[model samples]
Target: MTISFSELDFLKPELGAEFTGDGVHFAVFSAHAEQVDLCLFSPDGKEETARMPLPKREGDIWSGYVAGLRPGTVYGYRAHGPYDPSAGHRFNPNKLLLDPYAKQVMGELAWDDALYGYRIGAAEEDMSFDERDSAPFMVKGVVQDPNFDWDGDLAIRRPWTDTIIYEAHVRGMTMLHPDVPENLRGTFLGMCSDPIIDHLTKLGITAVEVLPIQYFPDDRYLLEKGLRNYWGYQTLGFFAPQPRFMAGDRITEFKTMVKRFHAAGIEVIMDVVYNHTAEGSERGPTLSFRGLDNLSYYRLSPDDKRHSYDTTGTGNTLNVAHPMVLRMVLDSLRYWVGVMHVDGFRFDLASTLGRTRHVEFDRDGGFFDAIRQDPVLAGVKLIAEPWDVGDGGYQVGGFPHPFREWNDKYRDDVRRYWKGDEGMIACVSQRLTGSAVQFNHSDRGATTSINLLSAHDGFTLADTVSYDGKHNEANGEDNQDGHSANHSHNMGWEGPTDDDGINTARARRRRNMMATLLLSQGVPMILGGDELANSQGGNNNAYCQDNEIGWTDWSGRDDPFVDFCGRMIAFRKQHGCLRPERFLNGDNEGPREIAWFGEDGAPMDEEAWGQAGRRMVVLYLAKVGTNGDTGKILDQLLIVFNAGGECELRLPAVNGAQAWTRVLDTGAQAPFEPVAAEETVKVPGECVLAFQSAS
Candidate 1:
């Protein structure tokens, strides 16, 4: 019962296809377009039935009202304008464009030459416009009913101090899971499956920071190489949850997953990419933004309008300076939080969002100001990648209050100290104490630093100890891609080895690093398969590896390590001294706790701090309250880490405690043992030992 374009109304201001009781209102912003046409297709999306030219234009937005347009309608847009790439107006009406605000897309982008704006192999390049109709090859927008019954489900709102972020890929987390059903595997529903929920519950994880689940297209080059984007970093739609990841109804299925996680008291934090789109570079396709208004959508070079200012290293950067673009970003974020019910977001390359008119990252930028002030985002957690390729983009300590920045210093120093580097003692000391130098400022607490050992962008924990350099030959770049400055020590071997001694040392080092991460004061994040000892065959950057190389191999492997990791996480949660909200202090300003000790059982002096080659130290933490109240003092714990040879450590004398009890020994083949602590305890090389006071 669709009506013709002759009687359509044009009075709406809200963007996207907003469904009222009897009609759907549509609006899109395109400042440089001569005209905009709404293309409505059949249910199958094979034939276009109506091409309704927008009759109203108000402040760069052309909108109209379609009567009797129901929820399952398939549609797209076509902007008719100049074909001049030099001026950045690359509008090609023949190439149907995707709606940037589409909540549910109908199809996938089929890789073909017709999808491009220019002639495929012409010498004129982007200057040569191709008249081929690209509607057949492009993805179309689906009118989605974004309604769901939460039935009293609400945000978990776990405090930052209690959160344990388990970063995982949505598909890779359960694609090969033995317990997950075959039909539900590799989908959003898989995350709520019994096996996955049971594993997360046992591990004591409070929040699962999932990798990018936004609508993304498989890169054409990756397709040619017979690989795909396993990481989903290259997003094509900000508002749409990728349909491939959905099992049935897009909106309802995602809401069900979120409800189940909420039922288990686990929050879902999404890793999002608002930096760039799939339509890349000057020679790339003329998709939504490019075809609609390229000049307003992308930041072009000041020297040349034909080129884009790509600080993200992703061909183009979204122009947030423009008000319309900023509004779109804001709306998209709100939709995810309000409509979709996600708890938080981890912004990839967040420094780019703060870049200003002077081409510098401003802490007081519009994006940050808008987000912190937004009523909906006030309670949501915000984590930043903290650094980008732009100038002065390494903002580890530069973020404002309440936003946690990923601390790369912690990653490097902890790895170096456990690897037994020559000059790592001082650096590791700061890292072990929640990286106070980088995060402790302007009322920002220690939890402002998100400490992580390995993430999806880098090697898994297994490969970190088994490979000295990145092995990315399978990425089809002749192994020239990925970071080369991996401060990794392979324990005298590259990749996997049959030598038992080397494997033992590697396992011990992993335990040592894991112990240091949990004992640190900042919020800790664990890469998904690190607990299961998942290996990528030494592939550090497997962004393009969608096969077994990127999937989590959940077959028969080391189960003891997984148990040990769970125990460690539980221990950290139980102990308050390990995760104080305030930094270590001596007065009422904060919690006066945590002291470093030498092997001789004395306070760490200047010489001990300066001992660059020293790889052994004892950590004594006062199990006291953060208020510095002297009335309620709990038992103190002593943690010893030995990266060198086995040393007999003399126990430290507490204020009012006598004998100690050994709780964990990573060096032993059977870890997590209990022993009556004597005056002196022998700690094995490349091992971690924990002891608690006995009254």
Candidate 2:
């Protein structure tokens, strides 16, 4: 039975008179409430409260239709029901609440006790409900038309093998950039500007994965501590983009950013947090999901109905195991890809999505299966953070096929090797070659691993070699919040000093780690400010600090560290053999690609790998050939890595190759130039050298 607009008794025409009869319908889902009122606010601060008793109630789903509501209409909801805490019902008629299906949130939430359904300082806490009206404090959701003309904009769909990802914060990336305009900085439009585009294109990265852009709120705990939620992990509204990031009219601004990125031939991937929401544990405030349906939306422990299952450690985890809950996640993903034209998604703490009602990880979980079979979402890129704080939540190499995972092992192993750790040669070798042991057996290839040394969650590359432990006094957590096992080794000092030997050692270690990341076989991801030696003063986790500690400082433009990053990325693009989708079989099936060698100019032996204090230089050579197998051989590229002190030995001679030329030397003086093939290039003490073999 088709329902017509005129026949719907709750129809009201005010803000959107243009599309009243145009087939657009409004439906909202609220389970516990007896009646839901739709309140529309005018531009002059006058409100027209429309009382619409839900026409139908199907197992707590109270939905109704309202015609003539279009984009830019400010509206909210007032759910009326019993106020009980022990039974998990916290509904209050006086408190105004945001609609769960809000497409866009207009402004920031002003802090006030009226926003909470329960009394702020009541003796019984959330048990006693307050009758104070919260209409002035809550943010209202705007009804968006969801109509945009995307003219020939399609996902670039770059394969993981050939992709290079650059992890950046949307606001911090361009906040201090000298090239961007003053007004555009710290907004979505600023990131898509020509200056930012030119920088990313010049670096040769294929994709730009921004941090959480979904509408989130600054937590009360953070606000009381004089801090803000800068990382955006504390999501409040899943369907709406954060109003702070919006430059103009909410919906069109985000669409414009996507179009601009598509025009630049760059793919946009968002870091999404579906594992939990901003609403904390049972004692937390009554927000959208919790206030709507606590039993259906969150995964509550059977033993204790008063508390929620805290797998995310963010107070509550979304019950993706539920059928309707799973639909909400899938619907949100498709909306971004279909309507917003986003290229990919990187799930934050994705392991929670695979948990079942029994609290066990399932490989064939409903969330994973649904996305794999989705027609529109199947073709796009899917990435996973691969872990959570739940019981049995570490599933790094356990993700299903057609999905890439952020390899934490890669980050740890690379750090240990560069820090001069003994017995790490064998482990480092496996990681540098894409960890075939972890991914090769399955249908996934080398590209299944997103390799990196440092990301936004941990220590920056500069601080990794300069501090041994986390120094988070500024975070107000008494330095007890972040990770304790950093596996970091400062050269000699605990913090910054003027010691030349220690400073030089730190610089060499940073270069070694960066070189390994670029030369690795899997897809590489570089943190935003690591190029200029950015540091957070040894703070491993800066989730709440939005000040200079998190922003990028471009003042170090003249430093050699930044120059090295620029050259390293350029060198990787020039050599195609380094980033292969599959492991090197050593049979020359594809090309005379990668050749492993020891310091003695011979094949690497198992004993050599086990020996302590032994560093090996891997020599990689890629020969170019035509599709017809009848073209001139292209120049052979050679990379030499020296992780130890200065040493002299006979260099390995290429088979059927006469000459080699030096292309890049990490230890060279100013005006470094490529040398002749016959010229013997001295291996630096702790540096990498790139050469070309041409006959």
Candidate 3:
């Protein structure tokens, strides 16, 4: 099946190296390159086999076919052009670049001065060009076979009302899992193993929002300190999965994991970082995008094109405003959804993506409009971090319809209220109702708010009540890195204490917060390992800790707390009133579907809501309305929250309800039976209780 070089086809439309049975077709986008050469390497990816210049150029793409090249061919690209940094065109023929559309990347990026386009000690810095070859230090792209046996696997598009996201790291999830095999641990195969799937199913998780699996490089500074980027936020190649996460050098391992998850009725949601790349500012290495078309790929400074317009706080931000760059991002997304079988994506630093060419955030930006109209992407779940470190970038509830945003407001206000902060009752109420003040417009539903208590960037749920201040000295940042205003309380002691009373208080606090997250009128996202009471030893920012501090400690899990979380999830699923499709309000409508009450068993007045010292509040949810005649009425639920000292609260009486069964009590940690509607129950401090009406 070998063909000669004269039989090469120069009209291939697809980018990257695609195998076509008899040979491989190479196509790349480099708008500024004077010449693009396809550099081929040996089977071991060490020695250069051949360097052939692409024979054809149509628009910005350079394409050519290499006869007799097989699926396992190792290749890279070298663009020869001007190295003028001031005008933002950095093209170095010595530095081999990775294909932006590469599906399979091989080898680790060895940090060396040779990888950079400039000399390390040059006084001119990035402005001076170096003639050293970057092939030995750079990573190479491998031609991949895109065929996979899906085995009748389709997407599990669970509705937003029923989706419970579990944010997990592909490696940190199963790294310390006892049941996982040694060889499979910290890999894609281990994440969807039998034990992991069983645990998620029992916990009632519908989707797993996995952290970045895209190909990224380890930071030189972190590696110098003997640490690694445990959280893969720095993306190098969007189309390629992280090579380390695969047990073997095969892209099909990720598909296998997805197939297994689908078999268990679980959806895979990737946390994608498209706002920036691993290549830093102008001084950074000439990696894939930086060397290809610097001016076209990055948002360079309007004043000085040598510098980057960094809205992501990362050194460089992707210039998605450009048509070609936008196409690349959209293409990467479609490739993931169409070929990888992933069900959703949580865009990291999404505000950067929503920014217009003028550097201001726009809800109707090109990125949003393009994805909203995309046929393949519109059906998949889209979640956004909703903000970046740029100016006016904190867009918590500012996203459009069908796009859910991570609600940091919910996390902070919930933490403050549970920590006994004054004047938080009002703020907590807004969060409980899905932050209606923020996201109630534009026909958006209550589930637009992705409610979360703790995530990967901050302290774990167990540490939230165990550490009053961040302990991030291990991050090599001198304890000055993570947020100082944590809005956290250490109960009576800091860190892990030997006292039983403090441990009990911490456990109760975790339960209260977890219950609040699940019972609220929004989509709940449980930080993975929170159910087992996982801790990072008070280190809120363990982004560089690849050791035990980052991995989930399965052996030291609290079995009782795990059971409590599982029960809470199951309870949330059983009751549809908790996750309402529409926002609940008391406008004196027909039958009054929802009502708020104070501790006195009466309707909450304006004075009660404005109380600075009020910590006890009641929520009454009923399905009664015009639909009652159609037999669509559901059982009513009464939820009570007591964040202050122990107090007695009289239960509110509802129509056609005789007895109320206490299904959940977060404080007592024990079983409870039914109580009458008129009975006054004593609620423990920092507790959450939910009662179901039995007619």
Candidate 4:
């Protein structure tokens, strides 16, 4: 039931294919195009039925309306202009382009020479043009019906102080899940299945920071090596959810996942890659952006004008400095929040997004200012992977207010301290207090640091204690892909070993790391599958391992460690002093809300902190008065972290409290017995012990 354009009708300025009950309005932005043709494909996308040139040009937007068009109409675009690469205009009508604002991208991209603008393997390289019809190979956009039965679902805007982010991969989380239906596995629906929801709820996770699920393609190079891109960081389309993650054609599957997560009181935070696109470089294929307006879409080299200004390490950095490109990014974010109903975003390579035209990372840049002032975006949680592979891009605490950053310092220092590194006690103390030296400015609270021991980019918690180095030979990169200095220590053995002592030591180290993450005065982010003690067989960089190597193996799970992590998360939630609303600065004139002590139970002086070999510290936290109450201790907690040999730690006396109840010990199993306050407690090496004040 599709009809071609009867006559050229005025299309609205709204980007993408907008179904208007009677017709579909197609619009796209191309600053320097001689002609823009709207190619309508068959329902099966096997044939291009009509190729009508957009009859209207409103500024940079080319648009037209086709009457009697339905929501499922498949389409693509072809911009005709100069094919001069040296001049930075790679326009080839032969290569069909995907809509940047496409809500649903249909068909798998068939990687062939026909998909490229220039002749492949030619002597002239990109200078020679190819007129092959790429419509037969390109993925087309679908006019999706935006209506969905939300069923009264609302965003769970959990405050930063209460947020416990569980970083997960949509497919990795449920691909091999025993409970998810076989047909639903690796899809959006599977990620929000009852079993997965129950697991997250039980683990006390407030939000699931899902890895990039936006429309991305399998790298041609990886496919050649019989591997696939499992991380989904190479985003192709910002507005379209990955077709691989959908069980069916409907884009509503993503919405359904969000709805279900909201029902379980868990927020959905998307890991977005807006800094770059899958289109590699000037030598890359002429995809949507390059074909439409190469100069306008990409930051080309100021000197060469042909090569891209690559700051993201991924060939080309998106020209977000351009108003049209910036608008597209902002619009995409708003669509995710308003239409898709996602609660937050974790911007991948966020430092690149803050780069201005001069290519320097600006804290108050256009991207940050736009998002901070945006009413819709300002309310949502914004987490930044605050560093890029560019110069001056390591902006850990450089983001403005209302934005939290991934604190790698916290990760490195915590791992080093627990790995028995000398001179790490001082840095570990700073990390435990939320790295106040880094994030204390601009009135930002302690929760501004998203503390993590491990993430998708590095070794899993289990592997961190088992592998001394990265085992990425499987990634086809000669074992030199991942980080060289992982700050990891193998407990007397590399990789999995049969020795019971090594296994026991690895278990204790895992517990200690998890305990430190929960006890820190910042938002804790548990790398998904760490609770189950999941291991990648020491493959720190599994970005290309789509098989069992990357998937979370639920079969060989560490049940005891799972229980320990869950209980630790519960303990963190129950105590307010561990995750305070403000920095735990003890310099105030009033009673101290936090204090660091040595094993002798005396307040740690400057001399004690300067000890290079010391690896044990006692953290005393007072629940500061809130809601207009006087700044006084409402409740208190004492946590002991021992990274060295076994020692007796003397307990501290509270103001009015008589005894302290030992609630948690990473060295022992749950159901801990209460101990007297006046007695000395034995803390083993690499163990964490928490005690609550009791009357």
Q: lDDT of each model, Cα atoms only?
A: 0.85, 0.76, 0.88, 0.90
| TM-score ranking, high to low | 4, 3, 1, 2
* lDDT tens per residue, model 1, 1-695: 55554354457666887777676778899999999999999987889888878778898988888778888888999999998888877889998988889888877889888888899899978878989988888888888776788898888889898989999988888999989998888889997888999999898899999999888999899898899878888887888888778877565777788889989989999999987888888778877898889999988888888888887988988888788888898899899999989999999998988885557998888888888899998789999999888888889989887688888889888887887788777788788778888888889997888999999987888888999999999998999998887678898999888999999888888888887888788999999999988999888899998778898989945688888899899888878778778787633333336777899988889988888778888887776742575545554678887888978888988655578998888877666778898998888777888888786
Better of 1 and 4 by TM-score: 4
Better of 2 and 3 by TM-score: 3
Per-residue lDDT of model 3, residues 1-695, tens digit only = 32234444457778888888877888899888999988888877898888878888899998888777788888899998899899999999999999999898899999999889999899988888899999998899999888899989999889999999999999999999999999999999999999999999998999999999999999998999999988989999999999999999999999999999999999999999999999988889987998899999999999999999999987999999998889999999999999999999999999999886558899989999999999999999999999999998999888887899999899999999999999888899889988999999999998999999999989899989999999998899899888887788899998988999999888889889989998888999999999999999989888899889999999989998888888888888888778788887677535556788887788899999899999889988876534446434465888988899888887777555556778778866372334444468777777888888865
What's the true lDDT of residue 338 in model 2?
Answer: 86
For each candidate in turn, give its C-alpha RMSD to the true structure in angstroms: 1.9, 3.9, 1.7, 1.4
Residues forming the 10-long window of minimal summed lDDT in candidate 2: 11-20
lDDT of 4: 0.90
Better of 1 and 3 by lDDT: 3
Best-to-worst order by lDDT is 4, 3, 1, 2
Q: Summarize candidate 4's per-residue lDDT along 267-313 as a digit string, tens digits.
A: 99999999999998888887799999999999999898788899899
Candidate 2 residue lDDT tens string, 1-695:
22223455554321111234443344556556777665666642236345455464556555556554555667676677766666666777676667655778877777887777677788876667777777777777776776677788878988776688889987888788898898888788988989888877766767899999999999888899999998999888887888787667557778878888888888999999999998888777666777666777888877866678889999999988887778778878888898899999999999998885458777678888988999988889899999999888998888897788999999998888777677777788778778887777667787888999999998988889999999999899999998887779878898888999998878777877887798788889999888778778899889998878887766654268766776788777777667666666655654565677776667777877678878656566564556775334454666767777776544567654556777766666631377764444457677777667766
State TM-scores per candidate: 0.96, 0.91, 0.98, 0.98
Runs off by more than 4 Å, candidate 2: 1-6, 9-24, 31-33, 44-48, 57-61, 81-88, 149-151, 489-505, 558-560, 587-594, 619-638, 653-659, 670-672, 677-681
TM-score of 1: 0.96
